[model samples]
Target: MKQLLLVFTILFSPSFSAQKTETFKIKKYQIAILGDSLKESSGLNFFNGKLYTFNDSGNSAELFQISLDSAKIQKKLNTKLRNEDWESLTNDGENFYIGDFGNNLGSRKDLKIYKIPFRDSLVLDSTKTISFYYPEQKDFTPKNLNNDFDGEAMIFLNGKIHIFTKEWKSKETTHYIINPENFENQAAEKIETFKTDFVVTDASYFEDKLYLIGYTKLAKVYLIVFKKSENDTFFRETPKKYYLGSAFSLSQIEGIAVNKDGIYISGEEFHSPLGIKKGQFFFIPFSDFD
Candidate 1:
């Protein structure tokens, strides 16, 4: 698989400019095995003072509030929306945005994000839809993990919604922007690309720092911390990269969320050749990485 050539691919990626990336192993972490109710937790977020997450596609349209101290489900917020492929969860200090655009096959044309209202620490049933399509993806051919339009991470920044693509073939991510003011069907303008040598599954922005986490096809997991550029950019500068062990060791790590306290990482229920499988939750403080 191309993921095996992560080091070489980072330096010679033909589609994007090549850059050298060195990874460090994060030594300290706290792990928690979540219950089966959150076995497919695909996204993590903090609403008001509570942490929340939800299952991926084929699951019910409900949001689960998690305990930051124990990583247990505390509450459930029911909704009428269909869970097509909820991949990322984020909030803009007011409303919560759930990215329902997980295109693993890369042939999906009905990509959209659900903007739900969060009032008094609860998500209201009435939600708004933000529909979008990539301008460069003219062909809707079923490429199945080979296409570039697939996405799983997004954030509400600068009054606009920014999405990061999970490039299955190139091992890179492209930042796309969707203006929220434009209500009707809009084009997600591609802005920039970075050869991360991994498929980004989720992203979180906090206090001018952007945290992007994903795993390679070879099951190598990574955490990238990108500082805010001077020009109000998120991916212009080189980021601090850390190799957070392997998915085989931590299941298929997928979701991430950051705040003043520390970082929260989540993984879905996975079965590996090692015959060990379960959803994983990790808590790593800011001091450990320093």
Candidate 2:
């Protein structure tokens, strides 16, 4: 009888010990205040030692650069391009890409991305805009367009643009690559598709790795890491989730960007009795994520 009890204890104890060995890594992030009451903080990008972001729905759709150390708006430049539905922002070494192709209802036939030159010394008083369209699909009025595709996150790589769709009621995402040089009424080619258990909001590529961010219905935020595969594909590695605590009491979170310094995220809004409050941005040190 004692021997039987000892055997059972060993069996159960090993299982418990294995479970104890498995742990989720939780990283801490610091919330940095950009603006108090921003109407719609859509796209965020950190480039050339400055952080840039823009408001979606606003009269003066200007791109503002903030100092990384002080977190203060260093320069606010009015963009020549209009912000009809700007969703995501990314930058290569030479130019900044803004995704004006937001199709929430999946009914936007005229989706486009604007490429503006990255000027360091000169204040961007005026900018040139170039547009590109998806070649495969034309009419936005698909029977199941909601489940098809939409644009939210973009990354510029190797003289081409890579766009990722935001899965609004689904757990899958589609990726497309476009050569802006072939924007003469040509369509962007579909590259690959990836599915995740979580709903992705934004993504950024840095140091040969892709980082994806998602917001749960409970207002929780999760970070997913993927390494580039052999054929220039992205494969999911280990995923870590973090609770961003709370931002202004509202839950809908969006916008993510990465630089050599750290990872940055912005929340949409929180529900309040008085009214809806503007979103805020947070930064996580790159070392913490590493």
Candidate 3:
């Protein structure tokens, strides 16, 4: 029996590992420089037939509309709200939500999301703020850069906001769900976790698909795609990953938006020993992955 079991283990192990280790290389179909105004563009979303993005922490509290044909800023709309490390954006056809819950130190208690009625107007002078805390997190003390409470990716689906944490220590992403109607301090319900081994910067949900963009600490770009289960949950299956080349070739990617035409990706400028890259936009056709 021992000899038979050993033979089965050896025969199946390699194939099983191969399934999880599979990665496809994707090249940028089109590249365009977004100029200095969007040097820190951290979130990407398509709304009203136009592409929109915004700066991350320590920059403007404004959102920008970029032209795909011209590859330049079409307009910059001020939000009149505090930036406060805004990292992600999502829209539900009526209103736009901005995530300001970038907790890199795992000590932040001021996580919030701004809801603006963008479908009615382009400029926002006010917004409804939704504050929340992770129910699974008990520690209020600072964990600095090693904390897993840090999150940069979020999406709105079926009246709920789905958030994915960028786990700094374990390199795993923990999923959470939040009620968008709740404005008072609320607890985010923990749902599932995925061992991504990379820091997720942004996420987009379109046509029953969850698309995520991230980069490793070494500046390697990655794209993860997950199909909703029969019950419409991502926890049911493992997402497939594609290695989208190095950040040097792709810039330090931070945002992703998917539409019927293609996938739109934006990266903030990166500077390191490897090299310096300008913030830019990239498009990948549906034919590349479909």
* Top of the candidates by lDDT: 1
Q: 102 in model 3: Cα distance from truth in Å?
A: 0.9
lDDT of 1 by residue, 1-290 (tens): 11122334433545433245455544246468878898888889887777889998988888899898778888888867899988888888788888889888888888998888887545565678889999988888898778888898988788888899999878889989888666688999888888888889899888898889987756678888888776457788788887787776676777888888889898887665455568788888877655
What are the TM-scores, per candidate, against the unseen true structure? 0.89, 0.77, 0.89
* Residues 71-159, model 3: lDDT tens digits: 58888888888988899999888888999998877888999999988853554655799999987788878886578899899999889
Q: What tens digits encode model 2's per-residue C-alpha lDDT throughout 6-101?
A: 223323422111101112222234365446534356667878767777766443557778665534677877666677777778887677777787
How does each model score on lDDT?
Answer: 0.80, 0.60, 0.79
Candidate 1 deviant stretches above 4 angstroms: 1-28, 121-125
In model 1, which residue pairs have backbone atoms overlapping below 3 Å?
A: none
Q: 1 in model 2: Cα distance from truth in Å?
A: 66
Ranking by lDDT: 1, 3, 2
Better of 2 and 3 by lDDT: 3
